[model samples]
Target chain A: MISGDPLSRVLYIDLSRRKYWVEDRRDLFEKYLGGTGVAIELLKEECPKGADPLGPENPIIFAIGPLNGVFPLASKTVAMFKSPHTGNLGESHAGGRSAIAIRMAGYGAIVIKGASDIPVYLSIYNDKVYFRDASALWGIRSSHTVGRIIREREGEAGYRTIMRIGRAGEKLVTFANVVTETYRHFGRLGLGAVFGSKKLKAIVISGKRTLKVSNAKAYREIYDEIYKMAVKTPAMRKYHDLGTPANVVPLNNLGALPTKNLTQARFERYENISGEKLAERFLGRRLACAHCPVGCIHLAALREPYEKEPYFYKTTMISYDYEPIYSLGSMLGIGNPEGMLKLMDVVEIYGLDAMSTGVILAWTTEAYLKGYISEKETMGLKFRWGDCETYLKAVRLIVEQPNDFYGALAKGVEYASSIYGGREFALAYGGNEMPGYHTGPAAHAGFLTGSRHSHLDSAGYSLDEQAYVKKEELTPEKVADYRNTYSTRYNKGGIHKKSSREIRQLT
Target chain B: MVKRIAVLDVDKCTGCQSCVFACTRRYGEAGVGKSAIFVRSLGGVERGFIVIVCRACKDPPCAKVCPTGALKPRRGGGVILNSEKCIGCGMCVEACPLGAIFWDEENNKPVVCTHCGYCVNYCPHEVLGLEEVSTG
Candidate 1:
């Protein structure tokens, strides 16, 4: 780390006391670096063993890497907490102006501890921190509205990042997410529920501080090299043109696209919802995270006529990716592009983790088919595949949680299926809903053994694809060996092997 | 011929801030504090962005308000800042209608664009370009 770099400063905010302080911990920054490395250490230091995830003891830590504002594509902000969903280590990465805003605010990490007695939002501008009352902003119907209202109320327009939750988060839904920059998110493991538990409605941060580099000439030369490569690369062009939805057609062709609760690994109507189709028909805009030359975030414009006024129509710009398409489109058997996007819009409005919510819904649909659950438990709505209207209503009920069934559903698929007698087909690993992958044993092993139980943990799906191309059989021992190799290669000589006892606990 | 950076299409900007960083890099730095060019969103990014820079106004408002005569009109249009003579009163920052004069908080001096067109090379979307105009 550079001497006098603001990356060594850690800002600690205690909502319980409405007090905040800054600590210069060059020791931790030097050893752990930043982002996940520093965040995990901070979590270990502040969060006590056996701490309740939704309680005041489970601290919320947000950290950014040293290269965040200094370099392009180092745009992610790592969030660490004890998850309300899994009751275990929670880590999610989000891209937007989040990392840049946090870094420019002159801190590498922010630790939010304790709970507020009343609803409040934290406003952080450079070194100043204010706990503003959010009484009027509470219980908002749409998360987008919350972002818009905060955007109007906040001082900085482009420089700030507003991270807030919607009704699902306020209701403490176990899979609720924190929406950042209106579209990006800490989208998994219930970070928003932790915020809800703390009565933290939102956090608005911005700064205009200048960052320093040790060597200016070398920095400019390397920056230009990277900038040139990013703009000229074909891979980046694909991302800018079609985004992650480009994976849909190929995954479906490979028979790795999980459909209808993973009962099948191929969707028959995949072409209708593929990236090419979406770009041709509905691509409205493309966005990029701060400092990134490649603008990959794709938004689809959905224009529909108002019911009362036939001639009047409203257009909505909703962002989409491969995971959401798999979860809400193929996995739910909803092939209609409009319907899939509408369902996605609802999930965004409520600020729920789309993958978890889709998997949970798939479990319920299967459970209904198996006669384990009935329409009575569903509160008069039938659980059927591709019925967007019914699924929309069910999502609302899950947030509302009017009955025991909805309450169970609000917890997660793991908990819901355990109580509802569908454990065999629950499709969750480590108490978290499965991501959009069913490639081979490596992907499954990665999910079962990965620290976060996420596909991004080790990218086992990429390994599965490699093996598929080579026509090689994948065994459990082979996966374990590959995982070790992956860890040693990428994790700076650290070898990771899960113990049998730990595996049992995770499963 | 005098060359000035022009915003080709504001809608093409993704609010990436690459140009902002590039402006700073031109001075052998890596932050936006000294950058004369800024891309701020109109309320939110969803609506689009407004690129604010010295449009090379022939008679710049910022230069007219300089108490220390630190700001001299450039040949192209915008004003050039002489940091040695600058009193750092920040009068020029409030004088511009476009708010293009960025403050260097650390140095306590105004950062005004010299119409060098260094940042135009970094705009990936072709949102910015350098245009040659007659110095009438």
Candidate 2:
């Protein structure tokens, strides 16, 4: 029954020293707010300058907003670290009980530092912390299996989130991601690789709490207003219906959907992967983040069998969003809808960043086709356009690092392109692979300056699309202003020296 | 005469969690320990949310075993807590099958829903609304 602001509490775990501690950092929460604000500061403190991105010193920071558990739309938890893939600021936002559970579990943030000598999983139940041995679960290929295992073993199934990594992370793939709740992920910047480097496997967090708020009347009023916007708004309705994949056809028509490694802006066979077509042909289920009214998560069921076995088959539920479709489908020339879904499924099972993996595969395909790398390099797999099976096989070999050429592929698109001669077509800004938008220069600018270098960093792509396609207006200044405004609002890491009382209260 | 635990529709709930914060705000704090209402996911986020609350039963086992007789039944099915009489032995907390009994360790008392319906006022989605039902 902690009183006042529970934001003051912090849970600390040491993988190297294998020690844990609790501290309070109320001042951090009071001033900077929560989520990205708190995580950046914590990252700077724990991450030594110029340290290895995959080293234990890199530090994994999960910060929840003050509004989480209290307000809607605030359920997102921000994950921050120096990305192994980009070697720069790596960040991703996730829902699905991650943020709400973290806040309610009686901690403002959970910091994992140092390295574990053996594989392990951390379970947080109420005020208790259990470091369970994870040797049996080690080397598992699918991220889904890891989540299913933890859900059954952990207490508070409905209330907990099992955040785990797959073979990609365990194998230290630079583009690996940390999967939560089987589907949602800290999907970019290689948080999964960092987890693997530390020999850490998974984290299960659950808590039932009583959070205090400031003016009960005003709180309810604001809450209702936001809730109304989410349910009744056309913006939410669009996502609810088709999810983000709805943008496929429209972006393709606008000549903004990056395709064939950005050599062509519009994917010629866009209808094959359009959101409308998917809903009509394959949409099996729609899911949402925790408490989110907009069920934008679209799952398409694809049943495929082993190439050698005629009788064996397995049904794969693949999650697809706008960026993955564009980066993996259009950009890689995966015009076949079923092929795109299979690629997406492999990416999820391997726990790699779909955008990064797609971009990397696209780079490899083009590079191999142009004779940059021949049969001597690709192990004799003819990497051709729309050859999804070879690309999927390439993804597995990238994790295994079967060839010296592919050892570099696991790094990321930017690194691969730099060594292999496709910088212009690399289509990556800030070292991380680009997301699925080619609206204009503002999108590039957002990637350039956005701390996380993400499409959502400023919604510049949306601004660019709306201007030229929606309104038929080409105002670069307005788009630039949009980027600047967002960067300032969310660019939270400041070198502020806090008083001891405040720092102790916050972390 | 509100007598039933409010049910929320996920199709209508925009994931605002207004009910949760409202419960805590009523206590003038910023943590979930004081919140009587909780909103969580069914499994993965793709599944949706389940809002757990006090059912406000007619025969609340919480009131029946109050060591200090602090948990008294209101005119409605909901129970009221007399903090002054509570010993905070947690008998009521264990007695609750709904897991709705809130313990305020700082005050050494149990927190119960008085059916004030403060959460309903904040519910923007109209997923929650007070319906007066007859208590048996």
Candidate 3:
């Protein structure tokens, strides 16, 4: 029922003093728009240069766009923080109830700063912000359990977003992630580590507020147009049908799918863990973001025995996306879909970034193969591709940090490879792990130069494919220039004084 | 003959809440509180969704329980709300078996599905359809 400009309210919470305040930052919202734009400006304002990414000074900012509550695919919440992994601009986008919940909560952005003395979780209900003690919630083995606990305790059923991390984040793993709604995540560049550093465990957000639009008729027209296109479009239909894992076979066929630690672009056993196979065999359910009609989040029901009891079994619903499939299945040489799901489940339980974990494990496997470090460094365990059991153990060790090697691995592939050798095949860009694109030089250059060094940063791989079809010769310099253009356009974060006409033109 | 929103395929419901938004938009507002139709997860999304909507009962319990005679059985199966006469006692919200009675927090009124089929148009999967029923 609360009205007015919901997009202008910026909520800031200081964990150190347990204080919360709202700022009317109309300038930032009006100029930058929202989501990435607002987050970037906040990140610049709060995160000082060379500030410790894990320090109390580093801020955690979550922003949702103006179109978030109103539009379908505009369901992403952009998280900006000084990454403990990358040591640079850390930006990750997650689609869940996160954006919608935040938007409905009557805020364009929420910034959490300072560190808490004890473990705690933030619950924002309408105008109230409660810093509840999360001492019991801390050290929980499974993030899934944590989510369930939060869900049971929280009042709002479908209208809230529960974001939590597990032992990996508690242990401050640089590649740890914050899982939201069990399936979606702020799953890159160690936001979980930052949360751990702040002694913050989880955040539950829910609100019921009416949003105002300039023109309702135009809005409805635009909404229908976009919705029709999104539902009927072939590209989006593919996403809706098989979800993102549908890209596996096609990317492999095109020799662009990174496999076995990027030693090969095409995974030979791609069909075994392909999207079609997974959908055919184990697709339990398909889910959409809060507003998105494209149900791209595919869950695979993994049933396994209790090991001790012959008849006892548990069916675990594990969510799968293309990046996770590539990182956990193809990159680590996991041919079996079940094994891949198991590994992904483990990663999710521990709240580790699957992509970073896979890349790190791939580097270690290759390192072991090259005799850089033996069983001694690996805590007497053999590292091999397609061996998910040992990989699971290794992932556990990374979170537990039982040994120095595991401790190094917890820092991410770039830092781990730098310490233990095998830097050549580390498969990391800007200290973050590489995505599943092995398209061309432009892709690599985009990864190298993109602000967040993410495939999503510029989608240079698609451009590379376009250039490839046209037989356009793209040098490393040209690729870098192209990437630079994107960085300059989107990455330069600041509050720009612009005329209303200019803003209209830009929109 | 009158039409009602029918959840033809529950499995096709992805829990997007587009229908909820679409329904609320009919009131010239944004958000789901005012929407007559509701979509929620069954424990978790992996299990599935429960699409809550008015089934247009033959002998509507909501109309029978109304204290102010605000809710009256229409020619069809559903009930029409007389906002002027009604007190927001929420008796109808509890009387419904399907939990389809949505409370508009701002106005303090029971917003039930009018069977206008606005939400049916926005359902991308065609999981929702308008089915004609002859009132006896």
Candidate 4:
């Protein structure tokens, strides 16, 4: 620790005024160790008590940890803001080039405040920053194209991170996400929508600055030890082999897959979307964040044919994990890889929250089936299970906010159901949609009290599973500890075998 | 028989900065941020990362451009800067297209790769490794 690392510095960028300045919050970094700890303080300082999440008052803060550039699995950057979706604490963690780029750019954190009158993207190079024109990129349907263009023009290749929003974000969908490094994201609670509200579409950071370490010799020894542990350890092996999709079967076997929006806890079609099946059927490649030995992100090879030319075929590589399967597969009762991949791709294109999007679509389907909504509300497209085309259309409509019904759905399951008639299985907590877990009351309670309303908050979902596995009763006190730990997010490195997500819990 | 080259692969990297810290820690005894090797993310994280250090080019451009001959390529791999002979003229920074060389503003001298391969061991993703490569 550099007692006061130069990164003890925080840069504030105001979009409304198109001005920027640096703040040396040495006190915050020294106390918090960066990331979530710093982000919470930044949020407190930047967001007004009664500020609208989508208003100019909301601030977006990005923070990386002390161990970030210096250690493995410490590559995650914590993003904090007042969520446009939840109107409370919005935090997300993403790996890829974000942490390293931010660190190398020589700052502990970057806080973005106010809204821009025109669309702009911030480019930070060594000792200088530029807000470039992003007018042409405002309506691009494909997030991939935005990345390709930015990568071609960016600085410090392999040393920069380009973060941008897709059409869903530009459209101001409450659940829109910002995509970075093709596969990583600040993926929850409408950070992208906030970006859209500010007329800010993207952020590109680059640097090659050096950092000082406290003990080089001991650092080398510890580095080697962790490297060997990463390669051989079971905790990381599961992530390396099958990635997060490994959860599909185990959760199913436990009768906790959240099939059809929790109409049932387990999905009978589990084998079709199982991690093993996906690895065998479509796993094309695997990749990891910078410096992490465990390549946990899995990409699937989705081979599709030309609709007009039956013989013509094109293969696309799509990233998949347990979350997508839960949100897009069983949650919607679709197990076919083709439909799942297409639906996932569309969700990515629109920049919507895949989990929230899937759960909302599922609720809409159930609502329509129960006659809560009619043809007039659906805008003629029947909300059906396992239909990729309609599901993709629904995701787009959410981005477009085509009607009042879809507009409410975009708000989230709980809010959407309040107007449309289905709170019993609305599948949301703290105004955010539920993750793909329904093990017991603890999972639900975790969402209700979990600061970010994220499944990883306290991993109370695992508590539900643990109780069932041990065949013992869980007292309310035990559950409260789990919820409190989740609320404080202060567990001292206890990520374990049962819930791998405990390792990557975002603030 | 001491053969070493920093081995980097595109496949196994997770874009983590463990190696960056390890490199910095090597100099951390005095302070942090003094490591020879640097690892950062390239573009968005999903696109992957860029790990920067001495590649130990067969005919080193950095050494050739140094007016003081401060940069010297060692046998094992990479160039080590001679603090005694060095003027902090940033010619090597401009000359080396890979941009691996670093001039510590605080130290007022040019810094390049020492090629101890300590950073390789720090890379948990196996993105960095020291292999034997002979150019003789």
Candidate 5:
């Protein structure tokens, strides 16, 4: 690490007091090397043990690594908080302008503590932090509109990163996410619920500064090498071509897609929602992170007509990935690509973590089918597989929380299943909803034991696939040991893995 | 032979800011404090990037507006700065409609594109390139 290559300033904001201060935490950055290292330490310091996840005490920490503005592919913002969903270590990562914007703003880590009394948004431009009133922007229908309104209001365009939540977050839905840069997110582990608890509606960060490199020539050489690798590598090409939704067909064919509450791993009508089909039909745009050249963020153009007028139509740009397609498409047994996109749109609009929302809805659909839940519990709406219209209604009910069952459903599948008696098909591992993969036993075991209890925590699905390919017999202890060693080595090396989100929970 | 940094295709620009970083890197920096080129989103990224660089204009207005004769019309369409003569006035910045002249706050000088074409190499999408323009 170059001396002062990544900024070591930590910005501490107390929402309760509406006071802010800066600390030169060079020691923390030096010891941990930023990102998860710095964030975990900050979380430990600010978040009390056994603190209420939605209380005023829980701290939200965002940190970036040294490679943030200096290199390609180091574009992740690690968000750590006490998870309302899992009630433990809440860690999630998002790639957009989040890390770059934060790093450029000259901070290795930002610690936001205490809860505010009213709705507000934090606008951090260079060295100044402004607490703006967001009373009017509070109850917007779509998170996209919130982003648009803030984007216009802030007027930073390309320089700023806007992170906000939708109605799900305002209502404190446990699996709600913080959407950043429109498409990207601090997606998993209920970061939005934490934001809701703090009454922080949005955060806009922008900055410009010149960083010194120990060796400029060597830095250029290394940057070129990484940039070349990113564009040329076939694995990265996969991301660029069709985005993550490309995995739909292959995972479905392999019986690893995790469809319909895991009753089947393969979707019968997988082609309709496959990456090839979606790109061929509805792909509207592709976007990249600040430093990354591989433009992988794919948005689908979903055009629908107004109910009153058949000729008038509106086209919505909906972002899609493998996890969402697996959860909302196959997991919900929806064959129509448009149907899947509509569900995804609602999830984004509500700022719900699509994976969790899908899994919870899948569980709800199965519970309804099995007579474990009835129309009374579903608020007189029958949830059938592939019926996105009914699922959309359920999502609205969840955010609205009209009754006890809907309120429980808003918490998460695990809590809802425990209350409603569908633990067997709830499809939650360690209190959090399961990811899209059903590759093997290690997948489940890793979810059960991993630090964050997330697929990205250990990437047991990758290990399972690797083991199957090598024909190796693996024990539970072996998987745990492998996870431990990988985490330790990568944590020290500062090597980030997209498959495992290795930056988050290395400790 | 007058070389100009021409934007070949704005649509292909990914707004990765590789060009921005590369331009600043020429002055021995790793970030975007002093870059002659600017790439901003046209509202959102879906509309594509606005690659604002020195268009190598004929009869450059920036050179005319400089009070201290710091900026002189180069062989190409843009202006070359003599840092020693610069008074750090705001005239040239307002003169250019493209906003291609980036201010170096630390040095108290205007950092204008000299058409070095270092950024063209860094742009993976081939959105920018150097072209020999007629010095009319």
Candidate 6:
């Protein structure tokens, strides 16, 4: 690390006292090298053992790496907290202006602690931090409206990130999420519920500081080399053209896509929601995180007319990706693109984790069909597969929590099935909803053992696919051995050639 | 012959900030504080973007407002900065209507685009280009 690099500074904000300060943590940055490594250490230091996930003792930490803002494609911000849903380690990564904004704000990591007495939002402009009352903005119907309002109130139009929750968070839904830039999210393991418990409505961060490199000539050469590879690489073209949704058809064709709560491994109507179809029909725009040349975020444009007035129309831009399409589309048996987009819009508006919400709904639908749950529990609503309107209403009910059934649904499928007698098909591992992969046993094993219970953790699905290509069987011993070797190699600071080739194939 | 950077298509910009960083990288830095060019969203990114840079006015207002004559008019348009003569008054920053005259807070000096066209190479979408202009 370069001397005088702002990456060594850590910002600490205590909402209980409305106080803030900055500390130079060169020791931590030097040892950990930032991002998840630094964040986990901070979480261990600040969070007391056995503290309640939703309590004040549980700290929310946001960290960015040294490569952020200085290099391309190193654009993710890692958020670490004790998950209210899983009661364990909660880690999520989001790509947007977040990592760049925090880096330019002159901090490598931000630790938010204690609980506010009243609803409030924090406005962090460079070194200054302001805690503004947000009581008026609480309980807003749509998270989109919250973002729009914050955008108007804040400055730094291009160099800021607004992260906020919606009614689901305010209501303390355990699977709720924190939305950033309207299209990106800290979307797993209930970060939003923790924010709700702390009475935190939102956080806006911006900065315009210059970062200097130790060796200017080497920096320029390396940057240009990476830029050329990013733009000219044939693999990157798929991401720019159709975004991650490109994986839908491939995964579905391989009989690896989890459909209808894992009862089916492939969807017959997968083509309707495939990347090619979505891009051709509704790709309204493509976006990228700051400093990343590859613009992989794709938004779909859905136009509809007023209920009674046919001529009056409005268009809504909803973002789509492989995971969301699998969870909210195939997993729920929704074949109509418009219907899936509409359902996705509702989930986004409420700031719920789409995967958990969809899985919980799938469980509830199956439970209803099996007579384990009834119309009385659902408030006289049906939970049939492919019924977008009913699912939309059910999603609202989950946040609203009108009854015990809806309340259980809000806790995630793991807890919901435990209560509703459908644990056999709950489709969750390690208290987190299953990701879109049903590739093989390794995927399930990875979900159970991965620190975050996320597929991105160990990428077991990729391993499973690689095994299939090589005509090999993936036993538990092999998976464990592979994980050990992979972690050991990563700890040594270099991924071997074979691992890199496997990664390229997976991508 | 003189050349200046032009905005080929504002809508083609993905708000990646690649060009902005490219501007600063030309000076051997890694941040945007010293960049002469900027790309801001139009209200929100959902709509589009507005790229702000020195458009090379034939009679530039920024140069006229310099108190110490630190800014000299270039042959084609815009102005060149002599840092030794600059008193860091920041009048050039305020005089520019487009807010393209960016101030380097660290150096306490104004940074202006020299129409170098270095950022044009980094724009993957061809949203920016360099073209010969008649400054009559």
The lDDT of each candidate is 0.87, 0.76, 0.86, 0.77, 0.84, 0.88
In the range A15-94, model 5's lDDT, one tens digit per residue, is 99999999988888889989999899999999888899999999999999888888877888999999999898899999
Write model 2 residue lDDT over A194-302, tens digit each, in one string.
9999988999998766665556667667866777787666636656787778677666766678888888888878989988888888876666565455556788877
lDDT of 3 by residue, B1-136 (tens): 7888899999988888889888877766666667898788887677788899999998999999999999998777889999998899999999998998988777898998899999998888888999998876
Query: RMSDs, each prediction?
Result: 5.2, 8.0, 6.1, 4.4, 4.3, 3.2
How would the candidate models be sorted by lDDT, starting from the highest? 6, 1, 3, 5, 4, 2
lDDT of each residue in A301-381, candidate 6, tens digit only: 999889998799999989998888988999988999999999999999999999898888888888998998999999999
Q: Which stretches of candidate 1 lie over 4 Å from their true place?
A: A483-507
The residue ranges of model 5 lying beyond 4 angstroms of the native Cα positions read A1-6, A471-507
Superposition TM-score, candidate 2 onto the true structure: 0.82
Residue A301 displacement in candidate 2 (angstroms): 4.6
lDDT of 4 by residue, A160-192 (tens): 788889888887788889887778888889889
Q: If chain B of candidate 4 is superposed on the true chain B, what is its TM-score?
A: 0.86
- The value of fnat for model 4 is 0.47
Per-residue lDDT over A1-507 for candidate 1, one digit per residue giving the tens place of the 0 to 100 score: 887689999999999999999999788899989999999999999999999999999999999988888877778999999999999999999988999899888999999999999999999999999999998989999998998899888897777899999998899999999999878989999999999999999999998767778898898888877888889765366567777787787677667889999999999999889999999999888788888989888889999999998699999888998899999999999999999999999999999999999999999999998999998999898889999999999999999899999999999999998898999999899989998878788778888988889887876776666566556787777777885533333321011112212222332
Candidate 1: tens digits of C-alpha lDDT, residues B110-133: 888888888898898999999996
Ranking by DockQ: 6, 1, 5, 3, 4, 2
Structural similarity to truth (TM-score) of each candidate: 0.95, 0.82, 0.93, 0.88, 0.94, 0.95
Q: Positional deviation of A321 in candidate 3, in angstroms?
A: 1.6
- Runs in model 2 lying further than 4 Å from the true structure: A1-3, A291-295, A301-316, A418-424, A449-451, A466-507, B1-31, B34-136
TM-score of model 5 vs. true structure: 0.94
Interface RMSD of each: 1.2, 4.3, 1.4, 4.5, 1.5, 1.1
